[model samples]
Target: MNAPIRSDATPRLEDYPYRLSDNVRFADLDPNGHVNNAVYASYFETGRVTLMKDPSKGLVPDGLAWIMVRLDTHFRAELHWPGTIELGLGVVKFGRTSVTFDQVVFSQGRCVASAQAVTVLIDETTRKPVPLTDEVKANLKPWIRRGLDLYQRD
Candidate 1:
């Protein structure tokens, strides 16, 4: 999938509709004293999972489950331990059987990493991709990325 066209301008945390805070753990550090690159994926996952798994969100329908099909990450800055990080996620695209999300990790007001993840809805029994239901689409509308024209994108 083509990544979104990012402007030279920096991204603001508030641009994302869904936001959460997490701590940078000592175990997340690498030999260079920066957060391990692999750990950023977990932080991004926490943002997406927290939003989709919330009962109030109504994202996952009965008898259905979401599975990650793709994740593209961009590491922006070095992050140190003993600090709190902010995570943000916003729905960027809705396909017939998949949802694409734009995610970010911020520390001390600076963006540390960003990613795009694609997840497809699947039948719990068959484990096959399923088209998104109207209810699920409606529930996701409010979570779209701010300043984006959802209809204009491919």
Candidate 2:
């Protein structure tokens, strides 16, 4: 387990310049008739992958991989099927070898679920934590948010 270094604050989705939209599938619903809680993580993944996987973005290198270390999710509201949702993600904190992402799921402009995840970059072959290079930082610079902690709960 890696130690988390709390920054001055977390950032919001709107604070970032980019986001991804995905739809809830009929099969995603649980017996309770709403999107299962488990699906929220996948939605978060979609947004993160979209940003990180693009070589043009330079967020992640070709031979490097990111692994999730921790995730804190708050299920504020339920999401129904037959609907579209937007996932917005931003950098909460940038560590020596890890980046914490704050993300929210919105349905019809209403926040349904939000999460904060800590991910570490590792060398694909060695599978060891690697420091974020200057190039990676340059790519991620556009996504960093400095103030207004979205993860703070009432």
Candidate 3:
């Protein structure tokens, strides 16, 4: 993974605090010549990890971790090789014990895929859900996109 390529020409994504860059590998392509569907999931995972590892912006504690509970994805365009892909990650909703993420994959400034995931924090020792601290919630507030609240309609 690499740092995002930034430019004034790039449109500001909703409210992503984290952006990760990844080059499309030959092995990522399927027989159809486009990146495989499963590869998209891995890309999203990479985005999450990059976001979580940032000491200033990440919330994954030393002894605790977030686990993906669900993921909903939509493939809008086929991704080709010999290109760099940018992934944008933002917090859509913050819950007592879970956090929802909204992510998008872009290639050459074109939106390739979109995904939403719900992840819950758990104590590594107890393997049980842990409540989000106030500090963590406050830190994540700036990344929340007001109208993109998915997986929590009610």
On lDDT, the candidate that comes out on top is: 1
lDDT of each: 0.90, 0.78, 0.77
Per-candidate TM-score against the hidden true structure: 0.93, 0.85, 0.82
The full ranking of all candidates by TM-score, starting with the best, is 1, 2, 3
| Candidate 3 or 1, higher TM-score | 1
Instruction: In model 1, state the lDDT of residue 137.
Output: 83
- Candidate 2 Cα misplacement greater than 4 A, ranges: 1-13, 146-154
Residue 80, model 3: Cα distance from true site in angstroms: 0.6
Clash totals in order: 0, 0, 0
Q: Which TM-score value belongs to model 3?
A: 0.82
* Whole-model alpha-carbon lDDT for candidate 2: 0.78
Pick out the ten consecutive residues of candidate 1 with the lowest summed lDDT: 1-10
Q: What are the root-mean-square deviations of the candidates from the true structure over C-alphas?
A: 2.1, 5.4, 7.3
Candidate of highest TM-score: 1
